[model samples]
Target: MTTNLLTRTHPRDDAAPVPPVRPHRRRRSLGSRIEPYLMISPTVLLILGLMVVPIVIVIGYSLMDNTITNPTPKFVGIANYLTVLGSPAFWGAAANTLLFTVVSVVAHMVIGVLFALMLNSKTMAKVPRAIFRAIYILPWIFTASVVAVLWRLLLDPSGVINYLLESLGLIHEAVPWLGLPQTALIAVTVINIWSGYPFFMISLLAGLQGIPSDLYEAARVDGAGPIRQFVSVTLPGLKPILYSMALLDLLWTTQQFTLIWATTGGGPLGSTEMLSTYTYKLAFNSYQFSLASTSAVLVLAASLVVAVFYVRRQRKEERR
Candidate 1:
């Protein structure tokens, strides 16, 4: 009887009235929900004002004629795009940009991977590895303008490069590297490769470190040589990082302006002209803002495509 009375007391609460939530508790819950949004509002506003608004304005300008300079700009409905698309100079710039971007990306990958492998070598002493890493990363530490100026001096007709070549009998006379159409693009590309590879090297080095040592042990157990193990394990492990970095490098290299502008100014008969240079010339040099906007929009579209791939890759990695 005593046990039955003790267990039965709580069952009567189902028939009793329920307690209501307090107003203070409700207000606290609402405040908690709103706190995160309030904290991020400033950043959200900044992005809208800076990036999103400017991109929207540029897209709007691309669809109009005589933007900014004229008070009454007329809607041209893609006429600027047509003009830009039909121009041979635009095509030439696009071609130059393509070649420069592809070559730089490929060279960066090769040099970065090689350096990463060298640094990752178990045979390398710590002191030598640290020294080599610092030296290799030195180019990346310099600003684009500095890199351009340094390379310009190095590639000048009377520069140390020419002096060395002459002393070594590699060439009979001084070569104006940036002044010649045949060598301008190649020179800038080499310069870019030198400046850009450190990023890849750093990224790939981290990726290589994350790879399981057990994988290498397993590969050796199967009678795999160094080359075979690298091919089977290292490459596969680094593939995601490689793809993501390549896409980012492609986007960045395509939009490269300061280095090219400071070095060659897209000169030597337009041999090194890129889309960015073409857009800049149209807007500032020729005072053709509408056409420049169109070109800018086109470049944005290409960048967006690469960005989408990068984002998708990131999402896939997160899922794994």
Candidate 2:
């Protein structure tokens, strides 16, 4: 038996059959590598077509004179930019934009944070909280055009607001809130504040909820009063959200056009004229398309600056 086993070849000792190589391995790998890009290609193309192309064309037009209106536009180099920069109207519009943006953003933050705090309070019942939230958020639900029209009616000389003020003896006569240069900017800023605060409130409320309960407990155990706890714990937890929201608000407020356009029409001697209104007047009213394009580019540059800060902040938060 031993002699027979030694003579027989074991299956393990036999030469194994070689499997055939997969011809499609390289193709499969290549497809795998390209799949993500193919999936994103539509979005990329859409952005390029819609955003990138328009921006490039605007930039190009900014460098030329009498663009769009003239068949053969002359290349004016930096002359258009220089002209826009040198204009007092542009400077005035810029100053108004700055005031509008700064005031709106600050008010939005204060009101939003305060409302968020009220909604997030533990003593508040859910039903009342919900009711107040709905009321507070109503402004944000209205479209810009709707908001503009609504405010215009309310601020009219014979409207409800003036009637109330007159009845309260705050003013002897009805005031045209949107008509006079003195109060036009203030009225629009207030309107913008009302429309914008709800977004901040919603965002900050979400941020408040994300704060760890343990942190609050620790603060309480340390004998921190409500004010102290808020100062140390609540504010710290909300800092990141506040920073991001503020930057985003800056960008949006800077580019605000629709509300300003519909409300005051940058009127009453250009009291409420913004960069947007200024650009619109340049292009359509003055027929200075090239100059308007330059202004548009300048606005884009400012927006980009804010966007860069926001992106960097997001990256820092992600890393942390």
Candidate 3:
């Protein structure tokens, strides 16, 4: 009985005792944890000083009647906005801007995806692929002014393209590509597509290369053809990249002005007029700074709408 009681009462004396764990270091307060912000203080200050302050001033000016010739500014409430909304020119510009954005973005995505797929092929050597990639990006690296001038030359009646086409009996006469409204729009859209697709191609190629080869192999093993494999595997994998690139392209193409201004100057009876170019003409040529500001605000609103829709769609996709 004594042995039994001793064994039960004093069991496992050689076993180690559990040590108490020290509590994790407490997180610093919001202000105390702001060292990163301090490190980037110069950039933050520069943005606020340059960008944010000017935007705020523009917002104020947009709310008032302040023209280029007017020395005195007056707060006219939403009158500027009303004027912009009532103007047929504003609607025309907005329509052109939207049309350009849609067409260019669609073309960019289609062409970019195709080019990326080609580059991603295993049959291409690394050297040739690199050379092709560099060549594709060369157009994007050119200054906008240079591209505009180059296209202007190309679109001229007796330019190399027209000469070649006429010599080949492809046309009866040299077409004034930028002089006519229809051709002008087409020329600008094509130039934008050519200049913009490289960025999308590079981004999409990276995304495609990240996708595991096993997915494609598995699809093939399951008796999937090329089209079927692309539909089932590639499309779903590239969803995020597509969404991001489309939104970026939409925003950029809608605001394009340099190429338009340098090429058409919103000419051919205002057919090529976009919001950005329209705003510039109003502020500078017509000396209507207030109206220009209002136009700019409208552009900002449209961009915000596009962005909001994209974000909502992305969230819906995520939920699904």
Per-structure clash totals for the candidates: 0, 0, 0
* Candidate 3, poorest ten consecutive residues by summed lDDT: 22-31
Error of 1 at 60 (Å): 1.0
Clashing pairs in 2: none
The TM-score-based order of candidates, best leading, equals 2, 1, 3
lDDT of 3 at 165: 93
Which lDDT tens digits does candidate 1 get at residues 19-80? 98699989999999999999999999999999999999999999999788989999999899
| TM-score of each candidate structure, all chains considered together | 0.93, 0.93, 0.85
- Report, for every candidate in turn, its global Cα lDDT versus the true structure: 0.96, 0.95, 0.88
Which residue runs of candidate 3 sit more than 4 Å off their true CA positions?
A: 1-34, 309-320
Tens digit of per-residue lDDT, candidate 2, span 1-320: 98678767454556688899986998899999999999999999999999999999999999999888999999989999999999999999999999999999999999998999999998999999999999999999999999999999999999999999999999999999999999999999999999999999999999999999999999999999989998999999999999999999999999899999999999889999999999999999999899999999999998999999999999999999
**Which of the two, 2 or 3, has more TM-score?**
2
Give me candidate 3's TM-score against the actual structure: 0.85
lDDT of 3 by residue, 5-89 (tens): 9999998789899998644433455556787889899999999999888777777878888745677888898999999899999
